[model samples]
Target: MVQDALAGAGYPQHVLVACSGGPDSLALAAVAAYFARRGHVDGRPVTVGAVIVDHQLQPGSAAVAAATARTLKDLGLAPVQVRTVEVAAAGMGPEAAAREARHTALEAAADEAGAAVILLGHTLDDQAEQVLLGLARGSGTRSLAGMRPSRGRLLRPFLGLRREDTLEICRVEGLDPWHDPSNTDPAYARSRTRVEVLPLLEEKLGPGVAESLARTAAILQLDADYLEEVANATFERLREPAGGGHARNDRTGIEQAGKGISLPEAALRDLAPAVRFRVIAKAAAAVGGQQPSYQRLLAAEALLRRHGSAGPVELPGSVSVYRLSLAQLEAEGQSAAAGVPREGARCGKLVFRPQRPSRK
Candidate 1:
C-alpha cells in the first residue's frame, strides 16, 4: 500500500517523511526508507529523508527530536532534519497553532531540501477521531470529509491501516517508539477522544464504530469533492462576463487589491441554495475575503431579491457586496460591476469589493 501510494504520486525525486518518533510515523519512515533503498518507483531514483519538528511545547521536545533524527539516520534515511518551532496559542487554540507552526517548519525543511513530496502518518483511527470532532462542531460537508490521503505535497499512505498495524510494525522492526504522553493527556480534545470517548462509544455502540466514522468521512469526501467542482464551474458560468468594464481586468494583482468581482443578481437568484451559497463563497474568496458563514451567505442572498435597497452586504476580510442598477453605475460613473450591462438591460449587478477605510 505504501509503495503504491508513492508510485501513484509519480515518486518525486526528493521525498521527506514528517516523522515524530511515534509508532505510526516510525513505521512510515521505515517503509519509506525501504522503498527508496530497495524499491523502484516508475524506475525513478528517489531520495527518502525525514523531518522531525520540535514544537517545544512539551519539556524535552528538543531531546525527542534529536533521538528521532538519530533513529532515522540509523534506518538509512538521508538528510534527516530536526526543525524547532515556537507554538504560540493563537485564536484557533494550542493544537491548531502548533499544527500551523509545525507545517511551516516542515515546508521550510522541504524547500531547503528541494523536496516535492512530504509523507504524513495519519491512520484510520485518526480519521475516525477527526470525523467525530467535525460532527460535534456541526460543520459543513467539507469539514466532515476529514483528512484526505493526498493534499498537494502531503501524502498519507496509512489512512487505510489501523493504529495497531503501525504498532505491530514498530515491534517487528525492533524499534522502541517514543509514546508521547500528550496522546493520553485529557487536556487535549483529541487525546480525550482517542482514550476515552472512542472506547466508551465502542462499549455502547458496539465495535467498528470508529471504522464506521472513517467510512462516513470517505463517503462524504466523495460528495464534497463533487460539489466543489460543480460549484466552481457554476461560479464561473454565472458571473458577469469580464469585458465591458472601464478597468483593464488586472484582477490578479494590484487591481484585485480593492475592486471586487461581480455576479448578476438575476442569475444568482435562479440557482439552487447549495450551489448559490458555494458561488457566493467563491465570490467572497475572489475579493480577498475569507469563507462567509452560513448566516452571512444568507444575508448576501437576501440582498439579491430585495429591490431598491442599495446594500453593501458586509462580509469578512473587509469585503462588501452591492446590488447596482446600470443607472446607479452611470450616475456615479462607477465601472460596471464585474461586467457591463447588456444594452438596455433591466437587471442589476452584484459587486464584491474591499471595504472603504474610514477617515479620521
Candidate 2:
C-alpha cells in the first residue's frame, strides 16, 4: 500500500521517511527500504533515505534520535540523518509547536538529500482521531477532511492501514520500536484522544467507530474539494480587479476602482450563503487582511444586506471592512461613524484597509 501510494503520487525517484523510532515510522522505513532495494516502485527505480528529528522536548532525546538513525541505517536505508530542533511553546501549545519544528527539519533534510517526497507515517487511526478532534472543536468541513495522502512534498502512505498493522510489521521484522512517553501523556489532547476517547467510543459505538470516522473523513474530503473549486470560481467572478476596470455583466454589480473591490448590496444578497461568505473571506485576504472568523464573516455579510448602512467592521490584524457609497469615498475627512479613509478609494467599493501602526 505504501509503495502504491508513492507511485500514484508520481514520487518514485527519491523519498525521505520521517522516522521517530515509533512503530509506525519503523514499519514505514522497513517497507520503503525493501521496495527501493527491489529496484522499483510501480516499475521505476527508487532511492530511500530516513530523517529522524529530535524535538529535544524530553530527557535523553539526543540518544533516542541517534538510536533511531542507527536503526534506519541497519534497515538498509541510506543517508540516515539526525536533526535536532528546538520546540518553542507558541500560542497553539507544545504539540503544534513541535509539529511545526519537526516538519521544518524534515523539509530541510529532504532538500539536502534531494528527495522528491517526504513520507510520513500517519495511519488510519490517526486520521480518525483528527476527524474526531475537528468534530469536537466544531470546525467546518475542511477541518473534518482529515489528513491527505499527498499534500505537496509530504506524503502519508500508511493512512489506509491500521495502527495494529504497523505494530505487526515491526514485530515480524524484529524491529524494536521506541515507545515515546508523550504518546500516552494526558497533557496532550491527541494522547488523551488516542488512549481514552477512542477506546470509549469503540466500546459504546460497537467496534468500528474508528473505521467509520475514517470513511467520514474521506467523504468530507471529496465534498471539501468540490466546494473549494466552486468557491474559487465564485470568488474570481465576484472580485473587482485591482486596477480600475469594467465589472462583469452579472447582476451582482461588482466594481473595481482605485485599489478597492466593491459588490452591490443586491449582488451579495442573491448569492448562496456558502459562496457569499467564501467570496467575502477571499476578498478580505486578497487585500492583505487576516482571514476573518465565522462571526466576522457574518457581520460583514449583514452589513452588505443592509441598505445605506455605513459600517467600519473591525477584523483581525487591524484590518477593517467598510460599506460606503461612491459619494462617501469622494468626501474628505468623514466623521468617526463614517470611517476614516486610510487609502485611495472610489464609491461602492468594499475596502479592506489595514490600520497603519502608530510610530513610537
Candidate 3:
C-alpha cells in the first residue's frame, strides 16, 4: 500500500524516512526499504535513506539514535543520518514547540540530502488523536481537517495503516523497538487522551472509533480545501498592503497570488456579502499573522463597515485593525502573512525596501 500510494502520487525516486527507533517509525523504515528493494527487482529502483532526529530531551536519546542507525545499516539500508538537536525548553511544557523543532530539523535534513519527500510514521491512530484534539479547540472547518498527507516536503505514508499493523510488521521483521515512556506519562495531555480517554470512549462508544474520527477528518480536509479556493477568489479582489509593508503597483500581479487580501475598508465594503466576508477574513488573517476564523472576520467586518474609529481591533500575531478613514482599513503591520515579502516598488500600505536603497 505504501509503495502504491507513492507511485500513485508520483513521488520522487529519492526518499527520506524519518525514524526515531519507536515501533511506528521503525516499521515505516522497514516498509519503505522493502518497497524500494521491490522496485529495484522490477527494473525500477529508488534511492532510500533514513534520518533519526534526537531531540536530546532525554539522557538516553543519543544512544537510542545510534542504535537506530546501527539497526538500519544491518538491514542493508544506507547509513542513517542522526541529528542531535537541542529541545531548548526543559521538561514537558512545550510539546508543540518540540514537535515544530523536530519537523524543522527533518525539513533541513531533507533539503540537504536532496530528498523530494520526507516520510513520517504517523499511523491512523495518530490521525484520530489529531482529530480529537482539533474538535477540542472548538474551531470550525479548517481546524477540523487535522493532519494532511502531503504538507510541503513531509509526507505521512503510514497514516492509512493502523498502529497494530505497524507493530505486526516489526514483529515479522524481528525488529525490537523501544517504547517511549513519555507516551504513557499522565503528565502529558495526549498521553491521558490516549490511555484514559480513548479507551473509555472505545468501550462506551464502539470499536474502531479512532478510525471513524480519522475518516471524518479526511472529509473535513476536502471541504476545507474547497472553502479555501472560494475564499482565495473573494480575497483577491479586496486586499491591500498593511502599514510598513510593501505596496503593489501591479494589482493584477498581486491579485494572482492572493496577497492583496488586505484591501482597504472602502474597497472591501463595495463587495457583496459573501465576497465581503471573505475579504474581511483575509484582511484579518493578513494582519493577525494567524488564520482568522469566520467569527473573527465577521467581527472585523462589523467594525469596518460601521465606520467605527472605536480603537484598534486586535487580531492574531500582535496585529491590529484600524479604520484610518471611512474608506480605509489599516492593518498594524505587513506581517499578516508568513514568509518574505515579494519583489517590487512600494504601493498602497505594503512597502518594499530593497536591501540597498538606490542612490543616484
**Which one wins on TM-score?**
1
In candidate 1, residue 55 scores what lDDT?
A: 90
Better of 1 and 2 by TM-score: 1
Task: Tell me each candidate's RMSD, in Å, in order.
Answer: 4.7, 7.2, 8.6
Ten-residue region with minimum lDDT total, candidate 2: 247-256
Pairs that clash in candidate 2:
326-347
Q: What digit string (tens of lDDT, one per residue) describes model 2 on residues 105-183?
A: 9999988999989999999999999999998887888889999988888999899899999999999999999999999
lDDT string for model 1 (1-360, tens) is 777778888878889999999999999999888877874566788889899999988889888999999999999888999998888865679889989999999899999999998999999999999998988877789989999999989999999999999999999999999999999999999999999999999999999998999999999999999999999998887665322333212232222134467787767776788888999999988867898877888888888776653666778887777677767656645454344356423356677776544422
Q: Local error of candidate 2 at 101, Å? A: 1.4
lDDT of 3 by residue, 1-360 (tens): 667656655757777889998999999888888866665523456777889999887779989999999988766566469887877576445788679789889988888888888889998888888888777777676767878887877788788888899999999999999788888999887888788888888999989899998899899999888777877885765454543443222322221122223444444545676656655556555543465566666666666544334333445543444444322333443332222132211112221111112222
The best-first sequence of candidates by TM-score reads 1, 2, 3
Candidate 1 residue pairs that clash: 260-352
Q: In lDDT terms, which candidate is top?
A: 1
RMSD of model 1 against the true structure: 4.7
| Poorly placed runs, candidate 1 (over 4 Å) | 240-258, 325-327, 333-347
Which residues of candidate 2, in runs, are more than 4 Å off?
241-265, 329-347
lDDT values for all models: 0.83, 0.78, 0.68
Error of 2 at 280 (Å): 1.8
Number of clashes found in candidate 2 = 1
TM-score per candidate, in order? 0.89, 0.87, 0.79
TM-score of 2: 0.87
